[model samples]
Target: MYEHLEYYGVSKKVIEAMNKIDRKLFVPPEYQDSAYVDTPLPIGYGQTISAPHMVGLMCEYLELREGNKVLEVGTGSGYNAAVMSLLVGPTGKIYTVEVVKPLYDRAKKIIQQLGLENVEVFLSDGKFGLEEFAPYDKITVTCYAKEIPPALIEQLSDGGILLIPVGDEYVQILKRIRKHGTKIAEESLGHVRFVPMV
Candidate 1:
């Protein structure tokens, strides 16, 4: 995993999280052997966990701290949220939403099995954002969006970072948006592909 992290140019903080968390624990039983291969694997319900390296890179972009609150727009297999929960430690919280009920339930159960008390999984439209926990310090969207969702930006706290993949269904451009006062700063993180944010 560290080797994959180096290939993605991820930060040391991300490397630590990657090293500490077991990717195999997040995938379905059949794919457990390939979990650390740095590639995405199907988790049923048409969703796939993002490549491990990509997850690391996205998390790195958030610049997470010990007590920060994070909103994860697509839970998939709950891998990202679980790794993030470790980064945020015991004080911080991770709210992850998955539109598919089965996927949400699976992820929720996996998180519980891991005893990640700080991570919460919800079954609902991720585009709406988790408003009950507004003003997240960081937001990470695991799926692709044609455009940045207004609700996500509105829920971001001042100086918050949002990492999302925006483009057509086939491919996307990873972007990092930083909220400043009433303005936003966007930076492209390069080309990629992901499942459409439904």
Candidate 2:
């Protein structure tokens, strides 16, 4: 799996996390057979797990540190949060939200089954951001939103980074937004397709 992710520029730490966090654990039982493949598997609620390459690229871009607190907007299947949790280690915390109640419940159970206590799942509208757990060191959104949420910006700590897909439901630009004091800088990572954010 590490070798496969090299083409996408994943770091050694991220690759190790990917290897250690069995995709099978995060995937739905019905799709367990496709877990290790270099493909996206469907989780219910019409959301698909992000492709491995995309996952690799995002982690590489984030440059996560140990104990970093990450806020993920869409916790579909908990795969992305699980992968990130591994790299950030037991000391790190991931507060992820899923708008769909069922997905949120399933993801929470899956993470617990994997013995990850650092991850927390919330069933709420992700667009509003999780202000209760403010000052996130990093923030990421799995689904595509028309624009970056101002509330998300408000939740990020100084010098924090947010990676989100921006544009229409079907076609969007992957952007990396960084915060420096009161100013925020945005970079267009590329174009990609993803599920729409509720």
Candidate 3:
């Protein structure tokens, strides 16, 4: 996994998380052998685990800290959240939401199976931004959104970074938005494809 991390240009934090967390545990049992292959595999429900390279790129972009409170949209198989949990450690909290019920339930169980005390799962729309736990230090929306929802921007803490893939269905741009007081700055990281935000 560390070899894959290096191939993906992962940061120290991401390397540590991917190394410590068993990718096989997050994948469906039948697909366990392919977990650490640096590729995304189907996990039913029309979802595929985000490629390890992609996860590494995004985590390196987030620059997570030990006690940061993070919110992850589009939990999918909970693999990304698991990586986030590892980075945030026991003192931090990671709240993730998946729109589909089956996927949400699957993620919840996988997270529990992993015994991640700092992670929580929700069955909700990622667009709504889980405002109940407002002011997240960082937010990563794995799905594609047309624009950064007002709810998400409002929920971000001052100086927080929000990353999302934004665009129309077929073509999208990976965007990084940083909050600065009442002002927000945006830059395109690059082009990418992500499932639409539900």
TM-score of each: 0.95, 0.95, 0.94
User: Model 3 segments beyond 4 Å from truth?
Assistant: none
Model 1, span 1-198: residue lDDT tens: 576577667877778887887888778899988988878899887889888888888888889999899999999988899989989999999999999988888889889988999999998898999999999999999999999999999999999999999999777999999999999999998999898888
| lDDT value for model 1 | 0.90
List, residue by residue over 15-120, the lDDT tens digit for candidate 3. Answer: 8887877778778888888888878888887777887889889998887889999999999999999989989888999999899999999889989988998999
Query: Each candidate: what lDDT?
Result: 0.90, 0.88, 0.88
Can you list the residue pairs that collide in candidate 1?
A: none
Show the lowest summed lDDT stretch of 10 residues, model 3: 1-10
Report the Cα lDDT for candidate 3.
0.88
RMSD of each: 1.2, 1.2, 1.3
- With candidate 1 superimposed using the best TM-score fit, by how many Å does residue 189's alpha carbon deviate from the native? 0.6
Give per-residue lDDT, candidate 2, residue 115: 86
